[model samples]
Target: MRLTLSNFVNYTSFMKFHYSILCILITFISYSQSVFDQDQVIEKTMSQRWELDDEDKNGTFKLTFYKPIFVLPARWSSNPNELPQSESLENSFTEVQNYDQVEAKFQLSLKTKLIQSFLFGHGDIWLGFTQLANWQVYNDPVSRPFRELNYEPELIVNFPMKVNLFGIDLRMAGLAFNHQSNGRDLPRSRSWNRIMFHAAFEKDNFQLYLKPWIRIESSDKDDNPAISEYIGRMEANAIYNKNKHSIYVIGKNSLDFDKNRGSLEINYLYSVKSNLRLHFQAFTGYGETLIDYNHKQTTLGIGISFIDW
Candidate 1:
């Protein structure tokens, strides 16, 4: 066949179109593979830890133990307030004024999935519980009494997704009904309930969680009416993992700059063994516990943390 001017023009156009399509396919495939590789890295890294409980396969009930679920012999808080005072009370538990400034802290935290791939195979149901206690073990005058205990329970529905926004991958979103309280009566009691919306984000070795909550009102049984003024309505947590060390920062704010009340907690963890980590934590702010919801304090503590969660 002999080539003409019109035929050569059409041939060039066809080649260009095919080349553009091939470039687009290559780009799409590269993006997909990158996402898949990242997901695999995260899953494998998390699977090696025993402290985390993973969801079961579709249409199954998975009950796994969340470890570092219990931390014993936690020590050090520069200041320990046995009874925190408010404007309503002239003196907060004056009887305990002689309480020791240093005591051991213990915590038990755990969670499990109740249902896997529920709601048209797009969501998961989970139950979680945590308890923290201050023990006067070294204070002989107190007979090693349990000074304070806060209990928390949560019901959560988590939906997983893969969406990238501004270089961050959104992994999951969830709603939770949470209740936290001190199991005490009258003047010593404190409790609150909230409906919270939470979401998870990740970029490289960094992960973040943002949770905002609305308080459920209890007309007659309101223990801490001004709790939100100090504890804030939203919380942000960030974690950075590298090599054998992980650092975490959690911040809460009332969203009112003028009032300016909230707290910040920083935690450092170093892997000491397969599932155990050396944990160092420092906190500055309000709502460290239910009883101290309105109190402001700075504390430092060191303990062992189970890294599986």
Candidate 2:
């Protein structure tokens, strides 16, 4: 209790020794715990943020609902040409007309994994569906009719990987069967099918997907016969996430170097919440939609997106 010099020095030394022992015990506990949980630490580090689902971590069927894959309201093409002309239909009705100069365009996409660990314990199967619609919301003459609805369904088999390729991590690879159609009758009907092979690569905050597809030729049931001529046989999608913003560029080409026909789409997204993002999109070239398969145009729009690549 008395403030003596000798007593104060003894008390200080005792406290210092106690503090050193406590720190040594904490370090030993931390090291031992890390060694005991080595498997968990490796699993967490290897898990990818951009993968759809990991079968080893996420069990059988996981339903991800109301996930907005690509949602944007755009100002679409005005003079929508390349109307499908059929001999069975009247020629007068099939003539190209000037559509609403600035119509509203929107897309809603969703996906879920129906089966997981299908084969080899590493592959997962998933089914994805998306719909894109063009609305003449502001056009008084058309009475705000839905101009076109393009439906897409895909069956994908994804395999996760950890291979290093040219300084980037090869994260995933898969094969998919894809079908897209605009549910319409006679002259307006458009549909196509493809077998697609895709791979995903990531480096730091950037991710890339390379998808090359082969058109499933259907001569008798072909609705949009020349669709491949513009939409292309392969596509490359790249995404970068940094500073609460995600930027994407998607491009497709027919690989016909002589013709040089392709399409390009750019998207910029700002994260507004944990699950919501403000999306701005611009597209130029052909195949913006089923009806606009052969028509080339440039469009820009802004909306909300719920998911990222």
Candidate 3:
């Protein structure tokens, strides 16, 4: 019998000193370089070319990054499917355990044009994973193993249309791919390869985003009986900012596990300088089906990060 335990990551500037505010969680990127990386970033994404803080006024080439991660182990076995009490066939742990994961990613942004206005084409890359259970019995044939890997790419067109919103920003991404090496890598090499299309409405402290997506492959082929397991998906995230942080809630549904699930997260960005900042975040709640199984999970974690904050 084969068992697989998987983990995932969150990448953005929280980890890198470059690319200021980037926190992406997956891969497959096109790489190239140019000048005015900073000014070019604000311009292409804001529909206005920017100059340096003091010297140059031309949008030149620049680089940015986001490297923030939140992971907790011990909690791995604390999943909804865990055997809360000691049973005839199993022994339970005496207490709770804590664990963590690491994440890192970087981006190269340049100014490009679309529809007579300056637009942005950002290339992002990330890598990381969470820690799994260390308990010995977890390896027993009677138990299950889980694991996950995620990657995503997005394309954006930020236009100018503002009066009250977060300065009016809209973006579109091309695709998001997630590969899995479940404890057993069972049935086949299963995963979620999705083609994502989205649009967002942003005004300083508020963001309204909607996404319709589709997943083609998965680990537990028989897990999703009602949804074809590989079809249409939907998700939403709304944010509200007050002072130095943003509070947001997310809802998601799709062909993958935990179809009807919601999440709440808090993002804290503390500024140290005009160009440097620190980021921290926390997550809770559960996903209905993890890796196409009757699984439930609750996650809690803390991370030290760098960003444009």
Candidate 4:
């Protein structure tokens, strides 16, 4: 059954997820003061990570974290869309297979600076790539095949800024060309391109990112028409870091009130040692993966993630 936003709010499992996050948040807030310096943590982290500050900036190219990279040993889905569908008749699948409800999932992402001070010694050009994959490792009958994999490559021109709005500090802004695809043949191939705008903000130990994109229309028969309705035209990611723990909330919306559709993802990361950390994730909505762009599901995952905010 497709899980709608209205029904998801009352879902027992989703309620449990919400409660767990609430408890975690409360615990973190309680201990936030004695554990870390909020101002330094927030400012230094963002500045160093994005090279927003001109002082001590590296001119040479070097790879860095662009997104969270994690491996989920066990990820459970409430409704696995075994038979994927698409608006394009040629890309729709009718065969339904009995796939395991639990699987292994992982994401690998990295970015590198390509040009420093490209725009009047202000903007820097960067190249980034991210890959997300779902593996049916425990499903022996299926021979442990990969259920889905999405590849995203981007080119961004980022600039540093100092602006404040309603007590929130705007740190940076950028423009990017993004391409995402699942490299598969007809009946499975899914791909899209976008010209996305980026804006980042920070205050205390909280950081927020707003990204809204305009889809690049293709003349070829589109594999997933109207994908924006499910995957969203814009997304916002908010991260709060205190001590060794970080909480992330990501929301995507189609921007249509009449046919409202979107997704929400909550992630908690506890640093175990160095950059390695324990990761927990809960997601409810559509477009969990490129192949499942139009499908809806609720999922929970526990695993290990590398990197710290």
Ranking by TM-score: 4, 1, 2, 3
Model 3, 108-163: lDDT tens digits are: 22332222223342322222222222222223242322333323233333333333
**How far off is residue 148 in model 1, in Å?**
1.3
- For model 1, the stretches where C-alpha displacement exceeds 4 angstroms are 1-61, 65-74, 86-94
Candidate 4 residue-wise lDDT at 75: 99
Residue range 1-309, candidate 2, lDDT tens digits? 888999898679668755874585456335434543433211112243324445435554554422235445447553555354433243213565436756666565655676766676777777787888777655555455677898999988888888998899998898999999888876788788999999988788787889999999886756666667798989999978776687889999999888878899999988664535678888899888877777788888777665565
Tens digit per residue, CA lDDT, model 4, 112-221: 99999876898889999999999886786776789999999999989998899999999999999999999999899999999999999999889999999999999988
Candidate 4, pairs of clashing residues: none
Better of 3 and 4 by TM-score: 4
Q: What is the TM-score of each candidate against the true structure?
A: 0.77, 0.76, 0.43, 0.85
TM-score winner = 4
Q: Which residue pairs of candidate 1 clash? A: 51-308, 51-309, 52-308, 52-309
Say what the RMSD of model 2 is. Answer: 20.1
What lDDT is reached at residue 225 by model 1? 81
lDDT of 2: 0.70
Clashes of 1: 4
What digit string (tens of lDDT, one per residue) describes model 1 on residues 1-309? Answer: 699998898679668755874585456335434534432222222222211224424233444433233243546666677666643463246555456766667567666778766688778787888888877655756566777898889998888767898988887888999999889875677888999998877777787889999999886747788888999999998888876687889999998888989999888877654335677878899988877788888877777655323
Task: Sort by lDDT, best first.
Answer: 4, 1, 2, 3
- Candidate 1 TM-score to native: 0.77
